[model samples]
Target: MSAAGIGELREGPLHAAVKDLLAVPGDRAEVRVEGFVIDLVRADGELVEIQTGGFSPLGRKLDALLDGNRMRIVFPVPAERRIIRIDDHGEVLSARRSPLKGSALDVFDRLVSFPSLIAHPNLVVEVLLCKEDHVRAPEAGRSRSGRRRRDPGERRLVEVLDSVTLDSPQACGALLPEALGAGAEAEGFTTRELAAALGVRMILAQRIAYCLRAMEVLEDAGRRGRAPLHRRA
Candidate 1:
């Protein structure tokens, strides 16, 4: 098979590198299974996929494979990012550290799009924490404000930092910020309370609740004033 896209999806440099780093001696790369081009099929028959972006795109693969196969979806999160600007000739113009620091909890932000996937026993989502270089090149024109435009170029993995795997509902629930307390004491948190506990905006807290609820880790406990309360299931 070619080093082409998996199931017609193109692979970026970062995607390819992560796969190479994660593959073991007995693993098979770019194998076709059930009409899907899986990233890796372990010797033990577990399917592994590397997704460098959002979870929404895994819909088809999950729908088809999660029924009978143990599939692991690896999502790479740039825990530390360095922005590299390149000129027309691909020579580096400048490089700087990005101010945005990512947390493992960021997996919840993306999981909001496919919250219920965690409920699938055969599916495991692994958040691969990595240091990355985000390369960019000049675009055709400048903005209305006279600032130069840059294309969103490919990302290159600098180093593998750590990883967090979510294979069960309990694992998903453990991602909750510790400020919410633990176990029984963490129950009855409204979105407002969840937001405060998580130190995030109300919208993100709502998304977190939606994901946790779909995973069956959190259940409706009743209402506190206007906000609905949730408790550990």
Candidate 2:
């Protein structure tokens, strides 16, 4: 469901910060269009949406808005994160740089929610690689892994490291590893090969393959044992 108004839309620090940075001088923020509240409507009539969460919730909103309008979905992936622990009184306890790194290809993880949307002529999926601070508050107990529990207090954007815009199926292909190649002369690759090439997990590679296949950028090239092979369509 669409938010009743801009004020009613719940956003964390990171999401709000990104929205403010993306807004242009001539753009209108929190605009109501066709019964949905658009994040930003440019002076030239382009719709911009900054989504810090999953894309599944945007399925209906995009379906309703994509017709006869240009829409850009801005998704931020934390290229680097600093973990900050906070005390009960909101005082900082400790801060450390997380070892995990994110890549532009991470967008495929979320794109799997609405893979076919990549084919829409009016839709542009913009992946913003950002450096961020992840603030956490201590929690009482931990049962699952017997580790200290922490709650997500806030996420603050530090800097926008880079951005990649997927405006067409070919643009989506750019997310694929260079080893994967493209066009009719392209070679087929399995999820294991994709994972190795991208330095990501097999699950993420699988999701990327799934999204690319749905976008028609990758087609079935037969199977390698239990795993499926994919090549450029």
Candidate 3:
């Protein structure tokens, strides 16, 4: 995929995931604070903001608003790799040990499954992903001092998996095909094309195809070499 295309792919899904998170029940409200549009959501009787982009500007604005009020901020995992935390002042408070587990769709599932969290009226949430150009940084000695390094084009499979919310085995068997279908269509790939398009190892694609078939979400279409096809039983 071209650089722009990769960005479009990530942004589209990231926005959907953010919308899913925001849909959690609570006194949900949005406001234009500073130069950023902030979504304020309540959880556990505490005010929180989901900070997506960066901390510099957001942290300063949030600190001013906090004014001694107990507050927390949540940011989406980096490419679904891991979640990071920030205080009202936008300082990096801590990094979550694990990425939000499950398939990308599972993230949405969790948000809906946990409706009680949305009932709170003081929380704010933000969701963001690192730009493709920032996906990897060069080693210190590899670049001039004070100059940020360019991102290598290598897409990190491990990081992507970490960032995703995987479904249970049964759920995976059930939902994998639909997710694959959506992914295929979004990427303009046919089933066979999709199996080839993952850019991951062929074995991984085959394994995912196998799981989908076992779930009855896919079936062999005569001898075309086990395409990433999906169909209802």
Candidate 4:
């Protein structure tokens, strides 16, 4: 289903590409209210915004729109990515798949930039796992003083593989990996313990801990040296 006015304004290709998948029947897109243009308004009157970039740009818009409004933030994290390099003449040169993989925990990297927004009562965050195509101009860089000045490449939306929603504290709690099993999460754990158990660095474990804490899914248990102790609430 297509939303009215969605195609009227020029939005990024990825933004426009995602609209068709998310908008249901009777949903309005690019709707203007009180001089602000909202991304979409669902049949249930839920405000939906797809942000592919940083949250710093959303503060003013969200503050105005979120008051007494049920809003959902749809964020896409690339699970699999393929790179397509093209020549200046737009000729396809080469295509290759990237080795890096993404998981739901990756959202914390972006979420950490603006963690406070996740705690909003009227907000629901939907993390989408997607496969994307990164289009690049392979021979586009220029040399200046033995330095490479590169043109910014582009990304295209390929597909959304799967999704998970965090609508409440408990929902956020559910994202904890099996490494932190029910007993472990409930029994309290130190960052060292979490890092050692997950085979991750202490810094990574700390970021994960911060995300859970901001979401109200985890709380302080105590401290183990510089690392903080936490338990699932």
Which one wins on lDDT? 2
Write the residue-wise lDDT of candidate 1 on 1-233 in tens digits: 55444434578899889888989999988888878788889999999988878878878988888899999989998899999989889999889999887766778888887888787789899998889999998555988999877688888999989999898878988888655646664658788878787667788788889988998888998887887988878
Which candidate number would show the highest TM-score if scored against the true structure? 2
Off by over 4 Å in 4: 1-10, 113-116, 139-151, 178-204
Cα lDDT tens digits, model 3, 1-233, are 44334433433344434545445676444434344344453544344554343444444555455453444444454444433444456455454444333233222222322222222233233223332211223233445566755433232222222232222334444434445445335432334553554443444455555544554445554433443334433
Candidate 2: segments with Cα more than 4 A from true spot: 1-9, 144-148, 181-187
Candidates in order have lDDT scores of 0.84, 0.85, 0.40, 0.75
- Give per-residue CA lDDT, model 2, range 1-233, as digits (tens): 43535534677789889988998789988888897788889999999888888889888888898987999999999999999988889899899999999988889888999898788889999999999999988665886989867586688999999999998888988777665655433656778888887899989989988998998988998887887788878
User: How accurate locally is residue 107 in candidate 3, as Cα lDDT from 0 to 100?
Assistant: 27
**Best to worst by lDDT, what's the order?**
2, 1, 4, 3
Residue 221, candidate 3: how far off, in angstroms?
A: 66
Clashes of each: 0, 0, 20, 0
Q: What is the lDDT of residue 18 in candidate 3?
A: 50
**Candidate 1 or 2, higher lDDT?**
2
